[model samples]
Target: MELQTLYNEYLNIKFKRGLPPVRTKPFEYGLYADDSAGLFLTDHPEETFTNWMYELIPRDPHYISAPDWQPVLADVFQQMDIYDELVLYYLLFTLNTTLSVNSHNAYSTMNDFMKNYSFLQLSHLSEITRLNEEQKHQVRDFFFFYYLYAHPVNEETLYACSFDGQNLVHTKTDIPLERYFTAFHDHYSTNIKEYTEQIAIAPHDIQACKHLTLQLLQCIEGKLAKLNMPEEKGLEAVLRLINDVDQMLQLHDNNKPALFEMMKNFLKEARSTPYRDHCFTTLLQNYASYILFFRFDEIHALVEYFEDTPEWCRTIINKIFMDTIFMERILRQKRIDITTYPNVTQFFEDEAKRIYL
Candidate 1:
């Protein structure tokens, strides 16, 4: 059969079914030739045709399902050995269409559909191995976009509810990680000292300072975990402080002032302690990366610098920048001025230079 004849037949079938005619001429030709010849065609013909067709036509069966389309795609793949791209594109197209039609709860449905198809595993197939680096990257990018789109929420549900000044309340059980502060502030005050001293510190006279610090650290850990903050480094810092206090008390007869002094002295002395540095580094990194992405004008850039820094340093930086500088002079407001803080802009610029350089 002549390729044009087969092409006309395909179009006639679609036209008779009241479907829009396939507008991509090259794809129409490839489909007709590959199907009629039942042989692999090489050169750029197959790719050019497939790409044109895939781009022009909606892959959803509901909108335009040509029963013979799959065989045509298979023939093209069999001939050119680039089947995975076509398969993945089709899957994504279908998934996108499904979600679009069911917009209200599309995420759950799309996630369920993705779970059924192991595209990640299948992409590593021998056939796919033949694809060039660009093609591989295209596949990877598709999946990356798909994953991000399907799972829009990154944080936990703990912060979904706000406290109404009396009791804890949750707005949604399935709240994302980004909404953590709404929940945290609902139950507890932002005054870190209140939570740490009241809830964390043990009241018994016989309780070792090290034990109290450890318990306090546990409370911090629990709260942070609820915030969906990764726990490894933060927990390690707490443990290190606890162990250091334990050793100091054993040698210095349980001197509370001495222990507090030691903590202060350690921060002052090391100036380069790995844990302390890590805290600051994490703070800066998270602020620069995550906060900027969210475009939050309220949070100062210095917040990131102080994130991985010691809790004490965080307090000090906040007091100096937020309380004294931004609140008192920069914006001249009694409250901290979130917008137009020059120091924060300078700090963020400096951090960016340090990072890039």
Candidate 2:
């Protein structure tokens, strides 16, 4: 039955019973049903009234019916609204086999879109379980397609949610947050190709850019937090700052030395101004630490390369400190906090390898 027709019937039933009709437009009935689930959290009789109304509504096209899993899978593919196929595949495969064997269906399964609407579109679902090589390839493709078509949104609602049992009230919060984070990390990392493509194609995608900017700063901070300032973190911070600038400037790989020199001169000149006592040594340490966190061995090679150039360790260190300070200002202004934003956290895990490796 059409959602509108079902909604009209539902309205009539609610009117007859003296229950207030759920305020919803025709197209929004499904969302209303999902939203109303929260109301049923209490064991009041109103919860039963809600469950009855939900049953009357047509099933969501994306809802998985385990009885006929194959057809359901086909239906999901046939109507590609928001469900992440790759995630679904993994969920199904694991639920039907591995996790089922271990947990005996103790935990909740399925992509929980109701938590956040653009979640599936903007964030990568974490992979808590393991998969074979073939499965990895399939997931990679899924990520590529979704991200390629994904658009920026100013604000988003919950698209769907992971359910525990028949009645929405029975939504068992058995799945731990860590599992979700792991799953998100897997999804993001596997889709490296798509991540790079999205960056190049949607450089102006405001939401994605905002998320990425925060992620960059978070990465820098995370690396810096692990080291001592001026002693160990200085060069590490500098390298990362250089990387951030290179990414911003789109500088050619071979021209990085020139970029370093330019930044070095800029810092040297700034010393006579209001910045004479600036703790550049500490700043460079943080910058270098950030680079080492992501790029590892690459920083060693970069350090060696700079050592042989006319601008040796001291000059290169000075240059990177200036860039680090500039990048740090931008990060502070942006107010980046990856820990607060799960999507940004996922993006960091996915893009960290690309930035450094």
Separate clash counts for every candidate: 10, 29
TM-score of each: 0.19, 0.20
Looking at candidate 1, what is the lDDT of residue 240? 37
Across residues 228-317, which tens digit of lDDT does each residue of candidate 1 receive?
A: 111233345433333232242232234434533443454555555433443333333222222222233524433443455556544443
Best by lDDT: 1
lDDT of 2 at 96: 17
The candidate scoring highest on TM-score is 2
Alpha-carbon lDDT, every model: 0.31, 0.29
- Where is model 2 poorest over a 10-residue stretch in terms of lDDT? 95-104
Task: Write model 2 residue lDDT over 177-280, tens digit each, in one string.
Answer: 22332333344344445566322222222222223223322221121112111212323434343324333133324555554554454455544321122234
Off by over 4 Å in 1: 1-276, 287-292, 301-341, 348-357
Report model 1's TM-score to 2 decimal places. Answer: 0.19
